[model samples]
Target: MRIALFFALILFHFSSISQSTDERAIREVLAQQVECWNEGDLECFMEGYWKSEQLVFIGSKGLTYGWQQTLDNYKKRYPDKSAMGILSFELIIVEPLSEDFWTVIGKWNLKLNSDNPNGHFSLIFRRLGDEWVIVSDHSS
Candidate 1:
């Protein structure tokens, strides 16, 4: 019984360590997206998402499916550097749903030239190989 308990503890410890590492990596991806958006690099910001037609994005405009469509929408909404403005994100929660999935809840703000648009968003991310990519996003 003691031997079995010892192995169980070891497994739990290693599982926690792996989850912690994954959490950090996920945060890094979000941080990079923020940097990209602030720099008015729409293309770079899109890199955080999965580049597949299966991807889904929900915004005030409506539901947009596919990676290319989402990128196009962003480009249309924010045409130039002035329109992109400074991007900021207030992350409320980053919860791990499973070993391979995470749900991120956050607020995003963009200080545009004429108006400031701020809203809350929830993103579903999936671990693919060595990286985590946003598979679905709901923002309003």
Candidate 2:
């Protein structure tokens, strides 16, 4: 019985450590994304997403499939620095779906000289090797 209890404690400790690490990683990924946007590098900001054909993005226009198409849409919509402006995210929730997946809900805003656009977003990130990349995104 004591042996079982000891193993349980170890497992709990490991799980707690992993949760903490994942939280930090998620924050870092978000920060990097914001930094890329602030620098007006849409391509760099897209690095946070899964670069696969099966990646999905949903917006007011409907669903867009493929990573390249998503990037293209962003490029078309933002156009220039005036459109991209400075970006910020207010994280509402970041929950682990599993050991290798996380779901994030947040508010995103772009601050521009003439206008500030704000929207809510839901993102799902999958652990790909050592990195966490967004596999699916829905923003409105």
Candidate 3:
């Protein structure tokens, strides 16, 4: 019984450490995206997303698949720096779905061309090897 208890304690400690590390990485990924967007670098902003054809993005228009397609849509929507504007996010929730998956909810606010456009977003991230990449995004 003591051996089992000792093993259980070790398992719990390992899980706690893993979760903290994952949360930090995920936060960094989201922060990098905001920084890239604020710098008017749409291409860099896309780095936070999974660079796969299977990746999905849902925006005001509709659903778009593939990294290049999503980048194209962003470029089309925000043609210039004035359009892209300053981007900020209010993270509401960051919950783990599994060991390698997480779901994040946040509010995105953009200050652009005299318009303050704000909306809610829900993002799903998957650990691809080491780093986390957003697999699916839904923003309104």
Candidate 4:
């Protein structure tokens, strides 16, 4: 019984470490996205998202489905570097839903020459293979 308890503690320790690592990785992805956006590289910005047809995004306009569609929408909305602006994020919560899924709640801001647009976002990230990517996003 003592041996079993020891093994369980070991497993719990490793799980906690793994969870912390995963959370850091997710935060890095978001940071990279912000860097890409600030550089006015939409393609690079999209790299943080799941490149799948099942990906979903909800914005001020409405709900958009698919990776290509979302990229297209971004391109159309922010046509130039001036419109893309400098992006930043303030994360509120990063909660693990399961071993391979997480939910993030945050606020995003875009500072442009004329105006700064800011909004709150909730994102669902999934571990697709070895990398974590945003599978669903709802921003307003």
Instruction: Specify the highest-lDDT model's number.
Output: 4
In the predicted model 4, the residue pairs found to clash are none
- Model 3 is weakest, by summed lDDT over 10 consecutive residues, at 74-83
Model 4, backbone clash pairs (residues 3+ apart or across chains), number: 0
Tell me the whole-model lDDT of each prediction, alpha carbons only: 0.93, 0.94, 0.95, 0.95
Candidate 2: tens digits of C-alpha lDDT, residues 1-140: 99999999999999999998998898899999999999989999999999999899999999999999999999999998778999999999999999999999999998999999899999999999999999999999
- The TM-score obtained by model 3 is 0.97
Candidate 1 lDDT by residue in tens digits, 1-140 = 99999999999999999989988998999999999998889999999999999999998878999999999999998898888999889999998999899999999998887888899999999999999999999999
> How does candidate 2 score on lDDT?
0.94
Residues 39-70, model 4: lDDT tens digits = 88999999999999999999888889999999
| lDDT of candidate 3 at residue 84, scale 0 to 100 | 94
Candidate 2 TM-score versus the reference = 0.96
* Model 4 regions lying over 4 Å from their true place: none
Q: Among all windows of ten consecutive residues in candidate 2, which has the lowest summed lDDT?
A: 77-86
Q: Estimate each model's TM-score.
A: 0.96, 0.96, 0.97, 0.97
What value of lDDT does candidate 3 attain over all alpha carbons?
0.95
